[model samples]
Target: MEEKATSATFKKETVQRLMSLHFKDEKTKVSNDALILISELLKLFIMEAAARSAKQAKTEENELVSIDHFEKILPQLLLDF
Candidate 1:
């Protein structure tokens, strides 16, 4: 089956602003392709983290995923990053 293209979870302008803030003192400029890649990577990371969090909640017999679920996955998510 073919995969469908989905809209990115992050806004391009927002990502650009964040990048600027992160490299405020640096003279280097971020390229559009690099920005796009960063946004896509961020979306992928969020999706994976949420999925894992939901699984963890289910495994623990919780009906709803909560902050604790996300906290539990933070270390793993950071490692993935």
Candidate 2:
């Protein structure tokens, strides 16, 4: 079966942004492998938080969230990233 296009695109974009922001910092040394590892490390938290935010937005408010919402939420888990 084919994957849904919209969700696949969204996931791709989200992953790209996550890599760029978290793994591509200029002052830090990270490689492609590290990017993959870090993404994997945080994937569950991101996915869960995204789902929760989506459900909350849907049932509780008229607003929807974008990948940027997750981007903002990620760094705050620690004082430094």
Candidate 3:
């Protein structure tokens, strides 16, 4: 439980740097609210991907989750998203 909560925060500076890369202005300033929203969305995406991959592995009677499992579910997962 604690681990899940702890993973929610992303590096603010890295996020800001990535955002700047896409924009024309290198001096663009990002608001904390916008950064927070992006962070939450990123966290949600990672969690959902992990859960789906785990489910695929379990259905195959495998305890270990692997890239193959993720690849199998990737198509439908993208559609669902």
Best candidate according to lDDT: 1
Runs of candidate 1 with Cα error greater than 4 angstroms are 1-5, 24-27
Superposed by TM-score, candidate 2 places the C-alpha of residue 62 at a distance from the truth, in angstroms, of 1.8
The sequence of per-residue lDDT tens digits that candidate 2 reaches over residues 24-46 is 45565556666566566566454
The lDDT per prediction is 0.86, 0.55, 0.85
- On the 0 to 100 scale, the lDDT of residue 44 in model 1 is 87
lDDT of 2: 0.55
Q: Write the per-residue lDDT of candidate 3 for residues 3-62, one digit (tens) a residue.
A: 445545688887878788899877778999999888787777778899999999999999
Ranking by lDDT: 1, 3, 2
As a whole number from 0 to 100, the lDDT of residue 41 in candidate 1 is 89
Clashes of each: 0, 0, 0
After aligning candidate 2 to the native by TM-score, how far in Å is the CA of 74 from where it should be? 10
lDDT, candidate 1, 33-73, per-residue tens: 98889999888888789889999899999999999999998
What does candidate 2 score on TM?
Answer: 0.33
lDDT of 3: 0.85
